[model samples]
Target: MRVPTPRLSIPDEPSLALPRSFWKEFARKNWDREPRLFRGLFQAHFPTLEEMFAALVDASERCLRGEIPPMRAVRLYVEHEDGPGGIPYYSMLFPLNRNHLPVREDGNAHAYLERVTRWLGGKRFGVILNRAQCHHWGHWLQMRSFLSGFYETVGVPLAGADSAVFFGNYRYTPFGIHKDDWHIFYFVVEGKKTISLWPFEALSQREEVPKEPGFIHRAGAIHLRDKAEEERLLSQAQLLEGRAGDLMYWPDSYWHRAEPSEGLAVSASLGVAFRPPEFVGAVAPDGWPDRVRHTELPGGRDWRMPATLRTALQQRMGRKSLLALERERTTEWVRLLASGAMEGAAPVLTEAPLSPHEWLLGSPARPLVSFPLPEAQVLVSANGHSRAIPAPPAVRRRLEGLVERLNSGAPQQVEALEEAFFTRLTARAFSRRAFRELLDELVRWRAVRRCEPPASQRR
Candidate 1:
């Protein structure tokens, strides 16, 4: 007689989807890749995932005082942009609310606003969210309580010793394949996430994937290795069918995706973020278990850059500056385009246009016209060769003059600037996209400010 396979039962009330052993199978195949302290720590149940969701809602509510501070920063990713963009991609980022979000309408949401701002400023851009202002506070509290139990359940501490700020993230939409560098705990408060795992070592040997929209399509067409290795890696891959009260523990460098199937779905998650330890060893020391110490800093600092070219460069070009520069630049660029300076232009496919005017002069003769941005450098010679250029003395002088005018603070004659810049080049030179990027960079660096032009200059 044939025996029936156990149907994965989900409770009518809030509950977890699978048994602890299922996750245990996943940990066995992947644990060796994690730090020793985190090995064998993948138990599926804890403060059940439902409880964790409750805690998160509770914390957000408690933190909400009257008149919530304006969301200091917010990053929005709509379904249209990221859905099939290739392995969890993001399009736009607003590191500061001034450039992106509307003014704060309520006072109670202050603490939530503050913590989110800190996270965005710190560059944790891809954290999931069900909505910007979730209305359920009790749900938040339950989520937090579950996290406390998670710490108790797992003997090894997942978060760093000094880290005080707890991070909460919820996955609403299905995320494509991706990986993160930090250590994270994912509690499924509601709905289900069927995750697929890979060795990550796979990505290391194969070619690196590009973030561009078109490039990813090309890569997928040429390299289709998923099927051959799916059985080996995916077979051992554990599915954390998280229901209302289930939590999935993943160590640092875990490569996985949260996939949604056909069903009504909702889930709350929390990521208690901390820095990685400074040193690596087969075994962790008492004080350095996960490796780093984190501390909650006092009230948020004004990382927003003040406008001054010198200070702007120092901050914009520095290692520490977050998205501040990028946002500022984007805002200013928008303003420039609105002024009609860069009309009917296409972004240069190569390194920055040799001359601002050259963009307006998109000529076929200047085939060496393309230059690669830092991220696009590999592709520069991939098609095989770099081109040679020979500019006459008059052309060189004019180009130099164009750069000086652009860098100058004085007002420019828009038409004149265009002609001088584009005169020698072909007509297809100007690009709205490139102009926007330059303006964004300028605004980010504080070289330009956003607001109405002075009345005297408006006409």
Candidate 2:
């Protein structure tokens, strides 16, 4: 199914605050415009490039310290000079520790960083940290704050969002010619990246690129390796080059590939899924609210709607009415699919569990202590979905103080923290139990952990 190629917009005099009218126009006019692209969308909105680089480094350090789970949050890639296909290639399946830190049998974290730096000196090596907001400590707080402001400015209900940090110096892309399902706002923090985008219509007209399998929700690159084929496609491609502080946006399903033009580059990609207000009405029947209280979708994924609403609607609606609604919904989905606005993954709700340290805090005699996790924030519902929210001012101050203490590599006593908390904020501000619960919540969320004193200091 070929769709119209959307016009890419690059505004002059870029501003951090885009008028709400811009977003409204973008949705009204370009929502179904395949391969929607925009440049300088976040001008002067985020932290400076130097700050972003520092944040990436800080996040890496935290990962090395067994804070961020390496497997889930970090991906390492090494590009090979020569491959069987005579094309630039890279491997992403490199093994890492549970914290996603690179495995170094004989050396420490410093050694690991040095080894990586040396490896990337001549070879094409890259590191990608997913959910960077969760690990960059306070360095990325500005970026998170900017996103919150953007959400309010756009006035759209967001289903989910996340940020990934990419670091590498490479001339080749790992996956060639692919598309994403969610809208991506990409910021080039350092170095330069050249991206080539091709419309689906152009690819369909050529035989060089075979029809790949249908994509599910997950984002994966469709491998297209023939140089001659790439040349053919480039004839009709839209080329974009981004440097530090430049921001770009591309709607889902826009076939594109990116490669660094310099030795090293760092960029952040923010993916968002926006649900229109009319979506619920379009998908659910009139009595859906009363019909199903809670239900599960296929694959045991929890449906956001209540099962009772789903059950009641299923039972009350006639087959014909259901079929009619299904057809309408299908049409809507097709439009969304064409524009890359549909969500690819199911919404996940993770239950944070209290850490062992938090469990010990209840014991007045044990003197258990806790330290905040780097860049940790509580997830709060914004548009019916959980989003990262910064801690309240007082709580943030306390956590920051604790983080500073932990950074000193010294174990702190729980009673001392309690005293500090009481002194900083009045005792009436939070009851002892309430304070303990707050600490427990932070522990459960992996934003803090219990600390044990050194054996020499234990007595």
Question: lDDT of each prediction vs. the true structure?
Answer: 0.32, 0.48
Residue 142: error of model 2 in Å?
A: 4.2
Candidate 1 residue-wise lDDT, 1-459, digit = tens: 011122112222222223445445545664434422122233443333333333334323323432233232123432322333232333444333332222233222233434554645532222233321122322322332233233333322223221011122323222345555434455433445555555444443445554454231121211334445434555655455555444455554455655534332334433432322222223323332231111110001111212232243344445534344443332332222111111111111223322332212111101111111121121110001221112334433443354344333334444456555556665344443443454333333222223333345565
Using all chains and alpha carbons, the TM-scores for the candidates as numbered come to 0.32, 0.53
Supply candidate 1's per-residue lDDT for 265. 37
lDDT of 2 by residue, 1-459 (tens): 111122112232122445667756765665436444465565454545444455455555656677666566677777776764466678785555433334434144334445666755656666776656554433233343334334444432223356677766656456667766656777777678777876555455444444566432225455555656566766767877877777777666567788557666778887665433144464433443311111111111111222443354356445764754543433333222211121221112244533323212111111112211123332211111222324555664664454334323345555666667667575554466755555545444333345465567564
- Residue 241, model 2: Cα distance from true site in angstroms: 1.7
Model 2, runs deviating above 4 Å: 1-17, 28-45, 65-70, 97-117, 137-159, 204-220, 274-431, 434-459
Candidate 2: residue 201 lDDT (0-100): 55
